[model samples]
Target: MEQTLQTSKMVTEKASPLSRRVTWYIFGVMFSINLLNYLDRYIFSSIANTVAKELHFGLDGIGFIASAFLIVYTVFTLPLGFLADNLSKKRMIAFCTILWSISTVFSALANNFLSLFCTRMLLGIGEAGYYPAGTALLSQHFPSSQWGKVLSWWNVGTTVGLMTGFILGGMIVSTFPHGWRLAFLFSSIPGLLLGFLVWKFPTKDTETQKVSLNRQLLKQASIETIKRIHQLLHIRSFVMLTAMQVFAFFFLGVTVTFMPTYLQQKDAFHLDAGTAGLYAGLMVVVAGVAGTVLGGILADSWQKRFAGAHILICGAGFLLGALFFAIAMLSSSFLLFSIFLFLTLFCVNLYNGPAAAATQQIVSPAMRSSALALSLVLAHFFGDAFAPSIIGIVTKYIDPTHGQHFILNSAGQDLRLSLLAFCPIALFIAGSLGIWGTRFAAVDQENVALPAN
Candidate 1:
């Protein structure tokens, strides 16, 4: 009888080789899609100088364009999250990919600042659905035990995409006439094809989990959505985690939007767009990859011995990242600046996987997408949406006044000072919140029903 039970357990525990291969294939496709998502979003930053000059945009105008995307992205995510929870996530992802890709193509045709701004807003609508749907889909496939590791690898797509965007945009703008437009046009192609691939691919979990709908059921689902949101907010750990993300993402917004320009204008560097892009991309990818992977592994391993190991790891990363970033901003030597910047990125990224997985662990399966969407809305709206503009405003105001107008300086000092003032403050807040969150992590996880493998 004991042998029979042991044999049954072994058979149930082991996944078939073919099943494992298919699982990895799904991960690969999703990773590629995520890469494209960020690449399209960040390419503008890579060629900000050219775009600003050609479009006759001042510093404030440039920041406004970036904020427009985040504003729209944040607003649309809630409804998309609702759809993801109730409908087929795979189909939603496919549709969003196609929509964003088309918008990206249209950006190439934009003739003026207004046209380009409109295109970016449309692009935000298309891309807002991807994260909530993608993360929910991942939750369906992997068990709680492996969530950190799986998500860490998935998050790597972000760094890779950012790197590609910076490098590709820089290369095109530097090498070709009307290169910024061409860059946008070229970036749209892969996403178009990838959208079809996502639609064609068989996602077994999505198929199996389809919910039947009627008027009564629709009403119930809507009610449940509201109740779940209230419940999620009530969870102390979840709220704390969200708070931590808010501050962390604020720094992220400032860095990604302005770092390339900063590096170019710095007295010690004075690098062109191409060189700045190459170096920034390389630094982000190398440090980001290492931090993401190591953070996940350490979080997972440490969780065995500590109740809130993931939160602890995240807190340390934020604190250390801020310290390094401060040093980088203060340094006069280019090499010293580069080294510290790499460390800053590495530490900042350490929370990506663990924080995401923690949210999933605390929420019920039905509310997973909504929770993530809400998190995104809060993080972007309060954190990143205004950061670029704030920095830009600070830069403009600090510049010497010429006649009646405050002239914008290209010396990089104003921008650097703005970043130094904001980034460290935000990072410190995030780290403190992360540490506070550790106290409630175990209790929150216990309240939720663990999803089956």
Candidate 2:
């Protein structure tokens, strides 16, 4: 036993420096890609009004376009995630980046609704492989103790990308003759370059043995994949966590898709698209940065004293976010609404890091990608996949007689009412699930053979 201990200590000491360097390197590259990923994804929403007017699409049509991207994205996540588990994640990421970038460029060339929808579908296919592969790679590099901080920092890429997308997209549309198309064209360039960079980076493959693409191996892999998914479903904590993600993402999807348009069209605000976009972008960046950093730090600190601390933090964030957002919707004063909006964004974002870290902690390393894949499938499909369309449908129902000549102010009222009815309910349910899931986190973590911190 003494000899074994001595050998283990020696091995750990030798691995530490190399591991730390590799961890940071991977984080840097993945972080950049994540940022680009969201920037490309959200460009359409930032310029939603311009696109809708140019293409002659109704509110429902606009929502459908967003939904199409998410639907394809959700559908492809599972199969692509399976590929990440069995293949070279670095190569997969590179290929995905290139494909998506090309699709973005194609979006710029699209002249009508069908063409644009097809390009968005292609964009979804390209982006589908990124999150599972990236998150799985990050989980492999860091131990559980550091997961919250690392994942939180990684998620900063998302908020930053969102801010850039909104501000940049707005600027392009306001400044250029064909700004929306130009925005897509310009965004594609960086993604193409990033793909090359990711390809050149010396990322280590997590899979121990490279399986050949033979019929026999493919058959076995499929069988194993099914069994693995089945096993994931049995984990009570994971199920609850996924359930929470569904509701949380639903709220997010609806807000991100329409909030700028809401500000621009509403009677109370009635700001132009560019100004609305800039304000909304600033709100997300300022509030998101502060909240994400605080959430990770607070969860990590609380974890030292209690089990399932991350879950508790997430629960609080959801409940508080719900309350603030509801107040923001109701308030007539612009200043009060902005204050509440900032608070709402901050509270909603608090879950970004902790939830991701908790997912990694509760699962074994081999199953991490699959676990995330399943969560994404459920959260996105049941949550955000239809949220925008549902909101649009609700708006149409509330003002059915508007027809082809819908008044902007009336449209805004319909949207606000729909959002007010749904967002709070989903958030409340998410919070309740988080609280309930805390009871299972300790046992779930114990079941996994986690690496030593």
Candidate 3:
């Protein structure tokens, strides 16, 4: 039976073609799953203040909880990445979705910080396998000719899920008396349901040959995995890009984490916890959608003419996003701030699709999951995971007089302003990395075309 399943996946991989409609369907389904994954994470951000207050968590404590998710995410990512290389991508994804959903549902039942932290950590473990497996599945399902475009659209799910989570989670929490717990519960349902769909979905032909799961991963990860990651790390361009991305994401995490509180404190926008969450969620949705669509289109067009076009475009987008955000911070008008926020999100998202495609093209198929996993490992550990928590601590420093008193109101702006410094620096570094990627584009092309393990 296992051998038959393996044979089925190989046939699917070889037969995957560049059909337009099928490509779109693949994008839609994958995007939906991606969205759900993020929605699960963002629920906490939308209610950071409420949770912190209720749990009596200080800045450091809150940061630790946020980072706890990543600690587990990082731990599981590489193992799962290797698993994707050896196992059925479809089954792996289905299992992961269910695991995470169960964990998320339990989040609402936690009574203390430790329990909540452990639940989130478990949630991270389930989520860890998602990206590498998802990416490998997409690559196998689509022809190489269409990878750039399909991956971009697939990447769009991140924005969509985040936006939905923010908007839905925020509104629910705001409107209902017990909205916070409800928010976590509501998000879990869709994910749990999606696991069934994922199972039903056809497996890629290349994925038919499932490897023995009993095989230990750390020992099995190829020399190529080590060499490729080493090469990626050593590349001056990638290093700069990673550094920039870390900072950019750090700023994003901090902002989103405290956005509701920022508005309440800075703009005097009095909202129920849910309303504030909805507003912040909307910000991510609008910005994420616009940025992804436009960025994907631009990256696809540029890739045809220039080897490093995607990276260049990514750099430019980040720079534009940073400028808009910086300008928005300077202005006090709510209307102006909204426009800038939208613009900033748009620019920031431009990198998502292109980065994923580029990463795939740069590494070997056998090593693809690990390469991507390593990236996520680095990004989560260094970027989004601790960003919100860091900003929370920073806010405390900015107004030590208030200590924890100002966490809910009037003090978040100081943190926002201080965080402004992170964006431009990140953009500059990302742009420099794009330039570096151009030099090795040919080398990557040579390595990527090698046959799968």
Of the candidates shown, which would achieve the greatest TM-score relative to the real structure?
2
| TM-score, one value per model | 0.92, 0.93, 0.88
Count of backbone collisions in candidate 3 = 12
Per-residue lDDT for 180-293 in model 3, tens only?
788889889888778888877743536334656443544655654576678667654455455556656666666666666566564345566666766777777777877777
lDDT of 1 by residue, 234-264 (tens): 9888889888988998999989988887777
TM-score result, candidate 3: 0.88
Q: Tell me the number of clashing residue pairs for each predicted model.
A: 0, 0, 12
Ranking by TM-score: 2, 1, 3
**How high is the CA lDDT of each candidate model?**
0.83, 0.83, 0.71
Stretch of 10 with least lDDT, candidate 2: 7-16
Candidate 3, superposed: residue stretches over 4 Å from native: 1-26, 204-209, 215-218, 222-228, 231-244, 266-271, 446-453
